[model samples]
Target: MHEFDLIRQIDSFAADHDDVKVGIGDDAAVTSSNAYKDMISCVDTICEGIHFKRSTLHLSDIGYKALAVNLSDIAAMGGTPRYYLVSLGIPAEWDQEEILEIYRGMNDLAKRYGVILIGGDTVSAQNGLMISVTVLGEIETNRSLLRNSARVGDIVFASGTLGASRGGLDLLLSQGLTAHRTEEEKALVIVHQRPDPQVTLGELLKESGFRIALNDISDGLSSEIWELAEASNVCICLEEEKIPISADAIKLFGKQSAYEYALNGGEDFQLVGTVAKTHWPTIQSTAKEKGIRLSAIGSVEHEGDSQVFMQKNGERTRIKRTGYRHG
Candidate 1:
């Protein structure tokens, strides 16, 4: 491990890398500000034990998800991610290819979102592997959505389907999918490893006078909706029948597992947005125009005890858990 932590040395207030023209002493590096529309900044961390397991995943997947998670945050805020800053903590004895493989993953996502990895710092970790990324995005200021902007009477929408990630992870672990045997489960494995951040859809919402109470389903649908309700000071009533669970996901995992996985699972990385009920058609058309599917699953109700209700078969039941809470 490197004796001096570069990030730690920069932690001193006097050492703030302000001259660099962007974020310095933070989780992921960032730029000063976005030139176009509104600027959004978000950073996410993936660790060996918590966010991911190196042995359980390939080097490429570990690299891709490390940055994809941050991009997902930008999408949740309804912004167009333009740049990324990456930091890596590696073991001293690790092979040189480790770094390249990680970049391969990050670059794979950056290519899809049209973002660039502007800069970052690297250092030796005393123990396990760690990767952090910060992404900066642009959006129209007035249209830039946030979690707190959710409003009562607004419709809750999710981009594309959900639950494939959780299902994929389960299959990989339960079946011990090796690099050789995973081809049969390629789609399942891909969902868990290389999740697509809904940037286009998020940008569409930002430009179309939509985008209120934005959040990405990184944790789970129920969890994100609960957060939106808390931020907007409202209650979200989700229709179970309306929640868009993907058919491929159901085929990979059974109905109950898939439904719960979609509801309370993590890492789906879908965009969840709120908007006026009347604008449903526009959202749909816009999503289609952008090549994403937007599904309306619920509505925001007047402020009360924060809770999410799942309605099925004309019966509404309180969902005991809202979403995942990271320790």
Candidate 2:
């Protein structure tokens, strides 16, 4: 397909919104901002071979995950996503219909969160397909959840289970796409491919009227907690048993391997952060009411070495900052 034809195909996915003055087809996207709120913007890129394999994931899955990962950043900041721009590096082998299917996957998730497609660029690539997404969001002024806000004596909690995404990726790599998968394996694969951003939970935390430190688990739990500690200039101690793991992950990968995934495997996309201890009961209760699973797996301590410790069976060991890192 020609460039304009591809642009037209993408344009069909744009939805009208009051905040977006000019969407696709424009030289630049013009958007209105709320004076009462702070705008949060984040960009993420996923590349073939590096982030995913075309052999395992469908084109639509790649599109969905590309947007989902960016949304997770907005959720980490406790913001409401408003608009996004997508830039694609299209390889010569890809067709127009396949490209449009990617947009369809993105549109499915965008409609759920009321995020509108604005504008972006598409370019020809010689090597592999690459998708870059830029997301813009709004948060209460001065109330954006930050990584550096953790205070001593605060309770550190994580939303949802960890390690499932890593397990899913492993299954895909080992078993191939067409191989038969157990029910648990299927669930894991789904988690890895189409992670649900915890936007509602993030907004709830922001509305709790408490200062909280939040970070999304794009990396593993160990790496994320270490980020929280180092950013906040505090030490964090986590109870291994308190870390939430899906029964599916445990059953499929075994307890030891599952915990390893939780600690070191990346791309779970769950939120992990610290909140004031006194405010924990209220937040936990409210989250439970919303049917969100939250676990207080750790606590923040006075600054020592800005380290993270994992406690297992009465033994405590310092964990290294290890997770998915781009080279």
Q: Write the per-residue lDDT of candidate 2 for residues 1-327, one digit (tens) a residue.
A: 355467667778878887654454321233456657767777789999898898778888899999998888889878888999999999988789989988988998899999999996888999899999999888766667878789999999999999999999889989988789889999999998788988899899999989899888887889888878877889999999999987789999899999989888878889998999999989999999999989999899787669999988999999887753221
TM-score of 1: 0.85
Give a tens-digit lDDT track for model 1, residues 43-68: 77788887787655788889899888
As for candidate 2, its clashing pairs are none
User: Positional deviation of 155 in candidate 2, in angstroms?
Assistant: 0.6
TM-score of 2: 0.88
Q: Candidate 1 has which clashing residue pairs, if any?
A: 38-139
Question: Against the true structure, what is every candidate's RMSD?
Answer: 6.1, 8.9
Residue 27 CA displacement from its true place in model 1, Å: 14
